[model samples]
Target: MLKLENITKRYELKKKTVYAVNNVNMTFHKGEFVSILGLSGSGKTTLVSQLGGLDQPSEGRIIVNGVDTSSFKQQDWNNYRKNNIGFVFQDFHLIAHLTAKENIEIALSLSGLTPKEKSDRAEELLALMGITEQRDQLPKQLSGGQKQRVAIARALSNKPDIILADEPTGALDPDTSVQIMEILQALAENGHLVIMVTHNKYLARDYSTRIVALESGKIISNEEVRPSKQYKDDQLSTDKSSLQFFTAVKIAMNNLKIRKKSTIFSMVSLIPSMVLIFGIMNLIFNMSGYKADFKPLLGDVLGKDNLLYVTPFEDEQLESTQKTIYKEVNRLNVYNPRIEPFKNTIIEPYTDDAISDMEDIEGVDKVLRNTYFDVIIDEKPFLLMALPPKAYASYQYGVPKKHYPEDHEEGIIMSSEAAKVLLQDNHASVKHLVGTDITFNIYNYKSAAIKLPSIMEEKNVIHTKVIDIMDISTKTKLMSNYHAGYIYVSYGYAESLRERFDLDDFTLFSYSVPDPFKSVVGVEVEGGFLITGPQLVADPLRHLRIKTSLQEKYNLFQFREFDLNMRGNNYSVKHTVILNDAFNKDSLAKLKEYGHVTKSRFDAYSVESAKKTNEYINYSLLSATLIAVVVILIPTLLVCVILYVSIILRTKEIGILKSIGARNKDILNIFTMESGILALSSGIISLVVALPLIQYVRNILESEYDLQASLGSNPMDYNMLGIITAFILSVGIITMIGLLPGRKASKLQPNTLLKHE
Candidate 1:
């Protein structure tokens, strides 16, 4: 039972006054069939709407079963609407997209019913309303009378204690109106409190047990039209469904069937967020550049393909090593990685002022000079050196700086290895080399004397040129003899007659690869045995030890330039003797067993440059493509917001549903489900559209030059499919945005819906 006392409602908009409801008192008893009659603007709707808790009065007291409803908070009222009330509207506010059965399902779905329970219950309800055959039809497919029947069925879905009807016959013809009255009358006879709001006095008089007439926002009469008798309702036997929040959501989803146009519009709006996703992908891809391709960035970069390597050798085996080198070079199809000697023996000793007129070399791109051994000066070790201003390679191993220090022309760079060696001598390498003219003339041989510096930091004897400093990783495998370390200027400068005239040619290389173990497979047949086992087991250190032990018993240094040629099973190598005294045929025959030792660490170092650039470029290109793909999120986000707004406007229908007893979660699901459908469609379209675009991109980006880049997006990639699955997740996320407003609409109480008279 509900009772209202001194109810007052007002609207104040820009100082204008509105008496939507004013000082009204009314009492509604259980099992009482009543009609609220009034003219237009008589506050008929406002009064009933307040009773249902859709709105609170400006000043009033409302009692439900002896308790004032005004004391209930919004959440408490929400529970009240969910549990106790049922509503029907004359507009037949069935969700247009949902089938008749689905419309009823939205109301009953909150009861935690099973799918089977919902299906069976919905079907039963439809049968009770004589619309079972039309249960699958949408509202638009049904006649007005059929639609109204569906609305009434939906209202009773939750099996509430009372029924509220607002203008139950407003849009019906007289004959149909009478048929609707018969339904209301029948319900009243079954002991239901049928409270209806309508303007038709004749219809009220014909069916209602009591007529409560209202005029000018006040009750004019409360009279009994017919006395009620005790009645039993077999159709009212509703099973208590244990519906939960998720169930309510499912119901809301079913209701969203009405807004097809809105759904399509929402999907269309999400394009920008998709674009953003693609943009992020682009950024990641562009930043790294190409890495896996065979193309080189620059000549020195090897910038794309080719491999270079380096290793130091014992002074004794130079001739034997040279023979193996020719054999390996002839065997491999890649760039020739020639062995270079320490620049120290080549560039050192130019200390005395013995100079010849110099001329720049032609066809040579750049020259790198570095071959300084650790040596002592005044009981302290400072690196004595020459540094190159430029070098030739496809890719740069060292990261480049945008700007260089001004004093680099007068300064030299040092490595941690060099620094530690110098610190032991009680003098800092940088300070000792700065401000003071020092001697750079020291040979690797301990027997050589220290000569004064002929080349100054600011001036060169040949020609003056800007100087730049650089540091690099170094190894002393071959430079075992005592010598100072230096890393600048050209080999030509270091090799002038005034410098030490002893060093030969060789190449040295080192690299920090992503995974050396994983990449070992690419190394094919070498002058050494072709390694065909797991990479982790290959130990270069152990092999070096074996070679070292063999060197002590044999004359390795005597054959620095001897030719060693091997193909398949047979190989020939050369050995030059230091003196005829040790050059007996027997001594040479003793070294024949180690002929396979031609493959040396020097080979690996010589090819380091070419290999590093190839790997780097291929890796860079793949990274760019991935980054470009991920950037699509930007466009996806843009589209999501626009769709969200469209969803809010489409939810006006939620009001109609709430007045008909749908729960908050029920409405949430409707909007979420609707948006999910739209999102799914959009995602599918995007993937279909993006596939060809990505293929086109793959073709365009095939090479740094006009050479074709490969399309690497694998058609059978499960991981890619997994990424596409994320679109489903994104749909749910976007659905949440639309659900918020739908939930609010569903919570609107039928009793608060002040129906316009």
Candidate 2:
């Protein structure tokens, strides 16, 4: 069945040529127990290696079943070895992790047999070798004789036409050696061409049907002492086959199980890399630029871009409005947010036609009128906004819609800053102040009627309970840029307060009326006003005060002096023109025609400043991310080193797999799968450890520091997108790192690999 013609194996040693197997002729038929007898360096093993397709002959041709192998490619040789030839080594190079049955099954795993067929075939071979009971034992647990028997059984499991044994009895005791020889003799008798290379001539004479003696690299004598049966069966054809990915996975898992400590160490080394990546992702995701310096002046009631604040433009207050600059810094925000207050009280009222014209603007959604008044709660000043029901419904912020003021509910909703001041605890949660009573002292500028200053004193008191606190879940320009604290009261309540204190009728300053002087008895002076009214006598800072009576108790008169240029009524009723989502440029320009318009935070300078601040923050975060990458690389490099060393240590196992018909792809798959598992394990463990830490930090910030104080939005909020992205990145990086060593392992040659120590 096999023929070798003029085959000469040459080698170069110390720059000199040596012929290990000289050109010689050889032929062997099927079912012949051939024993190759040779001393050390006799090339008997080299000759057998060439016949088994483990290595090619350096000279001449090897023909099998009349088919010359001179042009056989690597794949062809692999197929030849897989389907027609089986190897039994002296040392029994079975994989250490696999049991005896598993060792046999690995060979058939490449044959495209179903899992049950492979198992049954392995069981039959074990029974034939008289080692059925030891099928479940690993090579390390089996005795020397049993290991050799398992090796023979694995070789015969594929039912190859030729069995090549290289010193099959070399490592066993005498009795075990004889038993192994008897098994080989039985294989040759059962239609397998058994070829064994041995140094023991006595065993060769007793069991081998043909004894071939080799001296140097040449075969000297070939004799047949016993009759051998001629082959009657057809030669086995080469079948295209490969190791399945799941089979490789099974083998890889077995390898990891056997090297438990190494696998554990590999997984441990990758955990820190995973944790660092996840931590950096969280930090990057939480950092924001808009919350630092620039704030949005308008809330989300109407889109910020569509909400227009229209300040009445009069010639007298032109310079004041020009000088009014919106401060970007939080501490400098204490100035009047309205830009210019009511002066000697000329309320340029919006006439019916003017209101209709504003409503007629192209994209106008609605025209909202609101009033601002000065108030003091617990001796702290606040700007109270009297809002209509529509405004209350629009500014829900974080509170539910149902929590806002109902039709006639007179309670006030305060901002977090106002709540803290009222409760006298900056760190306390505003939610606790809900449903608690609060007293506000309403004040107006009486003496400084024209120019509002610190001289304005308390006039009336309004007692109410806090209904809700603004939930600043998201930071806006209004929260960051508005100087005064905010408190919201229903429109009806504010009107009642105005009437109770005569805020709109003959008061010195009327924000809603064009001229209060027409109703009250007053005369314009050089720099002030002289007004006659019974209410004026209560003025504590009246420059000049007098009382007069025209009749009995009913007709009474009082006089109080006031400065004409004093910052006029510190309060002003204003209207906001809210537009639809599709508002155009013409709409804004038309609105600006009536008064000075408030610029949004997205204006040029504000956007530029925010960009610069965010760039700096981005750079700082990038530097931290680079450091984290370096830290992560340290462990990734360790993983690569460990896998490389693992490949080196398992070279022998790699050879055994190749000899058992495993392709390079199979070896690659095994290592690749191992790396994937390691990366997945590290990612899962790191996330488990990091989630609790993030939650703990969030709780501390929310409780002790009140996250809303510094950050408008909570940065510690959990982001599953960041976590999942980090995990995928970790696995991809580690898997790529592992492929380096896997490729090295796949390129190894089985011929030289088997002989490696």
Identify the leading candidate in terms of lDDT: 2
Q: What are the RMSDs of all candidates, in order?
A: 20.2, 14.6
TM-score of each: 0.51, 0.61
Instruction: Give the C-alpha miss distance for residue 525 in model 2, angstroms.
Output: 22
Error of 2 at 84 (Å): 1.7
Judging by TM-score against the true structure, name the best candidate.
Answer: 2
TM-score, prediction 2: 0.61
Weakest 10 consecutive residues of candidate 1 by summed lDDT: 561-570
Off by over 4 Å in 2: 232-236, 285-604, 700-712
